[model samples]
Target: MIIFRPPKYDAIDHEKNLKESDGLKFATEIYKGQRSLSAIVEFVLSRIKNYVKKLHNFDQINKYIQGRTKTNKSKILLLTDKNKPTPLIKSIAIDYLSSFETAYITIKKNEKDEIFDFFKIDKDIAKLPQIIIIDTKDNPNEKEEIIVYDGDLNKVALSHYLSNFATPLEGPASKRMDLLNKHKNINNSQNNKKDKNKKKKNSKNTANAHDEL
Candidate 1:
C-alpha cells in the first residue's frame, strides 16, 4: 500500500531531502524490484517526482489532516494498476478531493504482488482493479487496519465507500454559476407558459360572460 505523508522542507538540498525520506526508500525498493515483485517500479519511481510536485500543489492536504484529527483515522493511499484504464478511479479521486480534501496515490500492477504478499491477500481473491484502504496512524507494532474491495469502476457501492473519505464538489465557481443560470432560465420558461395559459382562460371567461349578457 502507498503511504501518504505530509511534505517537509529542507532548505539545504531538495533532492537530498526527498532521498532521505521514507517515501524515497519505498520508491527505491520498488525501483530495485524488491523480490522481483513489480516490473513497473522503475516507471513509478521515475514519475514519483511529478506526483510529489502535484501533491504539494494539492490544497486538500490540510483537510486530510483535519479529517484525521476529527475521525481519528489514518490518511488514505490507493493501490491500483498503472496500465488499467481508470476513468472511474480518476472520477472518484476527483470527487474525494473536492469533498473531503483528501487525495490517494495509485500503485501500479507490478507492485501488487508485493503488497498482496505483505498484506497476506487470499489466493482466491481476484487481483486487478482492487482497492486497499489502510489506516497508518498510531503504534508501529500494531497490525494495520485495512479494508479491501474489488475494483469495479461501475459499482455504486465502491463509489459510496470512497465518498466517506471525501466530499465531491460541484466544480469551479464559474461552472456552478452557469448551472444556476440554466436552471433559472428553465424555471422562467415554465412560468411564462403558465401565465400565458392563465390569460387565455381569463379571455375565454370574459367572452362567455359577454355572450350571456
Candidate 2:
C-alpha cells in the first residue's frame, strides 16, 4: 500500500496578538475563484498565459493568491501545456505554487494521459490547460469539490505604487478569525487577572500563558 505524506500546514500562534501572528501577513486573502470545472480550466489557462505576459521574467512572480495560499491547508493542481511556460517558467511556477509547502502537482499536457488514467479523468478534459485545486478533500476526486484561482491581479500596478498597502481585514475568513482570536486573548487575560489580587496581574499571566505558546 502506498501512503502519501500528510500536508504540512502552518500552525497559528493564537497566544500572540494578530499583529505578531502569521495570520496578519500570510493568512489574509479572498478565495476569488470559480468552482465549476469548465470555468476553472479556462480561467487558470488564461491566467497562466497572462501571468507569463504580466511577468516577463523569473525575478518577481508576486501576487496576492501566491501569498495567501501559504498558510492553512491547501491542495492545488497546476495543469498547463508543457509548451506554454518554456520549461523553466513551468518549474518556477511549480516552485511558486509550492509556497509554504502547499500540496500540489503540475500536470503537463503529455503526462495527464497516464496521471488522469489512474484518477479516471476524461481524456479530452485532461487535454485542456488549467489548474485543479482541492481544498477540503484528502483525495483528488473529480466528484469532490474543486476550488480554483489564478491569484488576484487587480491592484498589481496600484499596490506597487502604494507600497503594497491594502486593508487589514483581507476577507471574511480573516476578519472573523482575527476578531475571534482577539476576543479570546482578552477573555483569557481577564480570567487570569481574576486569580490575582490586582488587575495589574496580567504581567505574570503573560509569561505563564506565553510558556507553551
Top TM-score: which candidate number? 1
Q: Candidate 1: how large is its RMSD? A: 15.1
Where does model 1 exceed 4 Å of error?
A: 1-78, 98-112, 136-144, 170-213
TM-score of each: 0.36, 0.26
Query: For model 2, how does the per-residue alpha-carbon lDDT over 1-213 read when each residue is reduced to its tens digit?
Result: 112222222233323443454444332223356668876555544433111222222122222123332233333344454434433233233233322122233454456676556445677744534443444333434233444443442223211221211122222223455688799999999987776645456777778889969
- Model 2 misses residue 126 by how many Å? 3.3
What is the C-alpha lDDT profile of model 1 across 1-213, one tens digit per residue?
Answer: 343333533422546676777654332222334445354544443332222111221234334333433334343444444433244544444434323222343444565565566546764665654555655446655655656655564635665565554434432223454688799999999999999999999999999999999
In angstroms, the error of model 2 at 116 is 1.9
